[model samples]
Target: MQVAILDDWEDAAARFLAWNDLPASVDVTVFRDHVPDEQELVERLRPFDAVMVMRERTPLPAEVLTRLPNLRLLVSSGGRNASIDMDAATQQGVAVCSVPSPRMSDSVAELTFGLMLSLARGIPQQERGLRSGEWGGTVGISLSGKTIGLLGLGKIGGRVASIAQVFGMRVLAWSERLTDERAEEAGARRVGLEECVRESDFVSIHLRLSDRTKGLLGASLLGLMKPTAYLVNTSRAPIIDTSALADALAERRIAGAALDVFETEPIPTDDPLLALDSGTVLTPHVGYVLDTTYEDFFTGYGEILRAWVEGSPIDALNPEALSRGPGDVRDGDEDRE
Candidate 1:
């Protein structure tokens, strides 16, 4: 079976995982760069019977999904991928499978705190000053007894909230699905979104990206933040309006902002956010790129391919696609039946 892996930008798929151990029947191909054009992506992927993708790097919209006729199974690194059009995949009879990575949250949660601490203590600024043969010239904010607003009480957010409590920071959390009981368990007080933003000394985002969450934090909401407060987002980029964030930081509407994700991957060299030299910290979305996470992800990839080749697909997100048959395997193969 022909398998294609897209957006292995680090070229880590072959080196970091056990791809050589995959059954000889599986012909695996990994694309180390992202193909931005939908038509180009479709043309490149048309020959493959299955495709594995990095989260949200290359979008599989309905139009793109309809063009890949040979595709039978799709797998993504994490259990939830906002990039794939699930309804389109289901309609096209394409089985989708995802590997669950609970520890992935641990990686993201750690980065979220790292950014917050960096912003609060001005660590980066101090390090740069020392390199220039200077001492501290700027005052840093203290985390203890400070109020931290958590935008979501999901796995990553809950972890952050617990850590905030350990630091003696008051945690206020808000999410549509977050229960009061759950917030109490996480040592966070449940509050309205606006109240959380308005009252926080530091605001951290940990919500999933979806239609309702896209541009959830616009200029109006950001404008509500205190001029002394800082913002950190290790979650999806579109959750906060990029233009609004750039404007807020450029004008010093907020004290500072740190981001690990962006609306576009490998942020454009000319992106407005990059021009601001002060009060901003940026990373290339390294939240879930740990060695352990990659091992968990690729091991699941190998297992999925093995199961499909053995004619009993596992971890299917779209089970109906399996009813169509075990994908377009080699002709007259006994195992295919």
Candidate 2:
């Protein structure tokens, strides 16, 4: 079986997994760079029977899936990936599997605070200045007595709320399905979205990207924020309008924004956000890029591949595809579980 691991940009896969330990018949190939073009991606993956994707780095839509006639097994690092077209994979008889994500919430929640603190105290800017023989000239804000508005109170948001209370900050939360009981459980008060944005000193977004949330924080909503307030988003990028945010930052509408995710990965050199001054702190989507997290992901990858090659596919998102049988290479092999 020919296996291709896509988007191992840090070259951590080989460090975590022993590729040579696989059956002598299996040939593994790893691609470190990203291929944005659909035709080019299709051409590159056309020869592989199995493909392992890191998160949403490479989107395999129906068009791309249909072009890869040899692709049989698709493995992703996390339990769920919004980028993949699962229905299309099922139709194509592709067995889609996901590895268990250990401590995903903890890693992302930690980064959320990392960005929040950096913005509050201008840590990154000060560090650079000190390295260049400069001293502190910026005034930092304390989290104590400040109000923090949480856009979503899911696992990660709940964690953030608890930590905010430790810093003596008031937590106000808002979401479509958030209840008063749920908010209280997380040490937060349930409030309307507008009130949450307008009243808080810090606004952190933890909402999932969907039809309802896409461009949810547009000009009108962002206009409600106090000029003294700061924004932090470690979640999906499309949830907020990129152009509107750039304009807000450029015009100094909000104090600043610390973003760990963007509309495009490895944001372009000419991206407007890059032109902004010290008010913004941008990171290359490293929310879940911890060492322990990668260890769990690549370790699970090895286990799943071994199981599939042994005629038993595990942790399949679309089990219906298994009913149709494995891809062309292992057509007659019966799936044990």
Candidate 3:
């Protein structure tokens, strides 16, 4: 079967993943760059029997899914991908699967601390100054004795809260799913949305992107932040309104903002956030792009393909597709538990 790997920006899928361990019957192709245009993407993907996609980099809407007649299976690196149209895949008789990486949450939590420290201490600015024969320009604050407000206390947010506690920083958290008992376990105090935004010295976002959270931090919530406070987001970009953030930074309403993800990947060059010098720090969405994560990705593919050949698909999101019994469709079931 012909297999295509989409949006391999780092070109590490074949090199780092255990692709060679798979049976030689599967022929794989990798696309290193992103194709934003829908028609172009549809045409490029038409020839593959199965395709593995990077997390949210390339969207698979119903329109694109219907155009690819040969596609039988779809695999995503992460377990939850809002970008994919699961309903469309099921209607088109495409089986969707996802793999989880144990280390992805920890890695993202670590980078959150790194971004917070960089913003608090002006490390990047000082490094740039030293390169040009200049000394320190302004005083920087320390994380110890400061307050960090977390938008969610999930696995990644809980990890951040624990680390902040060890640094002597007080942690506050609020989420739709976070209970008072869970907050206490993470060493965080449960607070209201306004209180979390208003009282924090550094506000970090860690919530999942959903209907309720699409614009959770809009102009009104962002306006509640202190003028001296900093904001950090390693989660989905749309969680915070892009225009509101740009206005806050441009007007000096907030001290600064650091982000790893954006509403638009490979952010447009003319984005207003890019024009700011010291008030913004941006990264190209490297939160879960570690080597360990890649290993899990390829290893999952190998296991998934093996299961497919044996007529028992595992971790399949769309089991109904197998019922069609189209061509080589299997009859067994081992869905994720």
- lDDT string for model 3 (1-337, tens) is 8999998889887587676677778888989999999999999999998998988899999889888889888988878887999877877778898887877888788899889988988888888899999987768899999999999898899999999998999999999777899999999999998999999999999988878889889999999999999999999998889999998999999999999998888888987788888867788999888888888877887788778767788999878876653334233420011
Best model per lDDT: 2
lDDT for each of the candidates?
Answer: 0.86, 0.88, 0.86
| Tens-place lDDT digits, model 2, residues 39-153 | 9999999999999999899999989997887888999996788889987788778999998676877788899889989999999899999999998769999989999999999
Residue-pair clashes per candidate? 0, 0, 0
TM-score between model 2 and native: 0.94
RMSD of each: 5.8, 4.6, 3.7
Shift of residue 180 alpha carbon in model 1, Å = 2.0
Tell me each candidate's TM-score.
0.91, 0.94, 0.94
* Candidate structures ordered by TM-score, highest first: 3, 2, 1
The stretch of ten residues in a row with the least summed lDDT in candidate 3 is 328-337
Q: How far out, in Å, is residue 67 in model 3? A: 0.3
Model 3 stretches astray by more than 4 angstroms: 325-337
